[model samples]
Target: MDADLLKTFLAVIRQGSFVGAAEQVGRTQSAVSQQIQRLEGLVGGPLLVRTSRAIRLTVAGERFVEYAQRLVDLADEAKRAVHGLAVQRTLRVGIVEDLAGFALAEILRRLHDEAPSLQLEIHSASTRELLPLLGFRYDVVIGMKPLASRGGVELSRLSLCWLGEWQGGPVPLALHPDGCGMRQAAIQALDAAGIDWRAAIVADGILPNIAIVRAGLAVTVLADALCPADLPRSQGLPALQPLSLRLFAHEEADRQATETLGRIISETLGAAVC
Candidate 1:
C-alpha cells in the first residue's frame, strides 16, 4: 500500500472533510478525493461515510485506524533507527490554542536547535478537540487541564486572568467558539457569580481573541504568561481557576522521541511561567 495514500486517508479522518484534509496535506481537494477513491478501491470497500455536516469512518475504516498508525509508526522508527534523531521525520502535534499561539514558536525553535532534521505538523484546537485527536491523529498534545486521570507531565500552573478595559454595559466577552475549556471556564464563572455577559466576538484561534481584547472590544481570559504586558488585567470580574499546562503523549507514539520533544516544549514554555 502507498504510505502517502494511507496518510491522506488518515488526514481526511482527522480533518473531517476533503477540503480540510487537502489543506493539511498540501493537495487539491479533488486530489484528496481521488486519493480516497484509490485507497477504497485498493481496500475493496468504502472506508468513510460522507454526511452533509461531517465525515465518519465506516466499520472498515474504524478497524483500519490502528493498523494504519502502526504502519506509520514502524516506518518512522525504521528510518530513525538508521539515521538517528537527525533523520527527517514529521512529528504530528496537537496543542490547545493559547499555548500554540503563545509558546509554539519557541518550542519549535528549541526542537530544531536540538534536532535539525525534525519536521513538525501542528494542529491547534481547544482542549476538547485536541484530547480526542491523541493516539490516533496526533503524536502528542499540550493542553490546559488538571493532571487527573489522564497521565501527562504538568509543565506549569498558569494563573488565569481577565484582560480588557472596564465596560459599563453587559460584560463584553471575546471568546473561542464553543467547546473550549478556557471559554467554558469563563462562562461558568460568570454564570455562577450571577454576572450578565455577552460574547462581543467569537474567535476560532488565539490571535483574533487577543486582538479583540487589545482593541477593548471585549474581555478575554488568558494565562498570565500569555497576556501581553501592555494589557491591563481587569478587576471586578469573577475570579478564574488556574490552568495546569500538561504534555500528553499518544500511547503508540515513539516514546523516546516524543519524550525528548516534550522535554524541549516544557522547558521552553515553563520558563515563561517562571
Candidate 2:
C-alpha cells in the first residue's frame, strides 16, 4: 500500500470532502478522486460511498483507517529517525496574538521537551492574518474558529468575556483592527444588543489593546483564560459567545510534530481553564 494514498485517504476522512482533501494534499479534486480509486483497487474493494452532500466510509474503509494511520505514522517515524539528526527540520508555526502569552509559553516548553531536534519559527498575528498563510508560510496555525469555514481541528473553546473597568456610557472599546475574529464578534454583539460603542483604540495586536484596557481607557473582549486577574469582568453588557480554538496543518507537514504541538496547546489551554 502506498503511504501517500493512505495519507490522502486520511485527509478525505478528516476534511469530509474530496475538494477539501485536495486542498490539504496539494492535489486537484480529480486527482484526489483518482487516488481514492487507485487505493480502493489496491485494497480490492470500495472504500468510500460518495453522496451529493458528504462522503461516507464503507466498512472496509472503517477497518482500513487504523492500519492506514499506523502505516503513515510508522513511515513518518522512520523518516525522522533517518534524517532528524542530520537534517534540522524547521517547523513554521502561526498563532493568534491572544495565545502569544502564557499559553504560548507552555506550548513552546512542552514542544521543546518533546521534539527538541525541531527548529521552530513562530509568528504571532491576528487570526485573519494567519489563516491565509497556512499552507504557504506556516506548517501549522493555531487560530480562532468560526472564522475559518473548513479544514481545521478544534482544540478548545474559550468563553469570551468583557475585560476592564466599565465607564457606564457608550462603551469605549479597545479592539483589534479589522479582520480580527474577536473584533467582529465584539462589534456584532454590541450592535445586536443596541449598545452604543466607540472604538477608543484600534490596535493591530492584543498587547496594545491590553495596555489600553490596563490604563482604564477602554474595555475589550478576551478569552476568559487570557483575562488578567486584576481586570474585572464587566456586567450589564451583552454576553459574548465562546471562541473555538482550532489547529490547521499543511497536508505535507510532519504529522507527528504537528499533532504533538496541537495536543500540547489543547492541554495547556484546558489546564488553564480548569
Per lDDT, the best of the predicted structures is: 2
| lDDT (Cα, tens digit) per residue for candidate 1, span 1-274 | 7788889998998888999999999999999999999989998999999999999999999998888878877887887788874556777888887777777788788888887776778898877788887888899888887424356887777778889986655789998888666787799889999989998899887789888888878899888787668887888988887777888887777676688787886677565553
User: Where is model 2 more than 4 Å wrong at Cα?
Assistant: 1-88, 271-274
lDDT of the structure predicted as candidate 2: 0.87
**TM-score per candidate:** 0.62, 0.65
Top-scoring candidate (TM-score): 2
Q: Residue 128 in candidate 1 has what lDDT?
A: 75
263: Cα error in model 1, Å: 1.9
Instruction: Give lDDT: candidate 1, residue 65.
Output: 85
The per-residue C-alpha lDDT of model 2 at residue 203 equals: 88
lDDT of 2 by residue, 1-274 (tens): 7899999999999999999999999999999999999999999999999999999999999999999999999999988888866766688999887898647777788888988888889999988899899889999998986534477998887778898888577999998887666887889899999999998999888888888888888999988887667877778888886777889999988888888888988888884442
Worst 10 residues of 1 by lDDT: 146-155
Clash count of each predicted structure = 0, 0
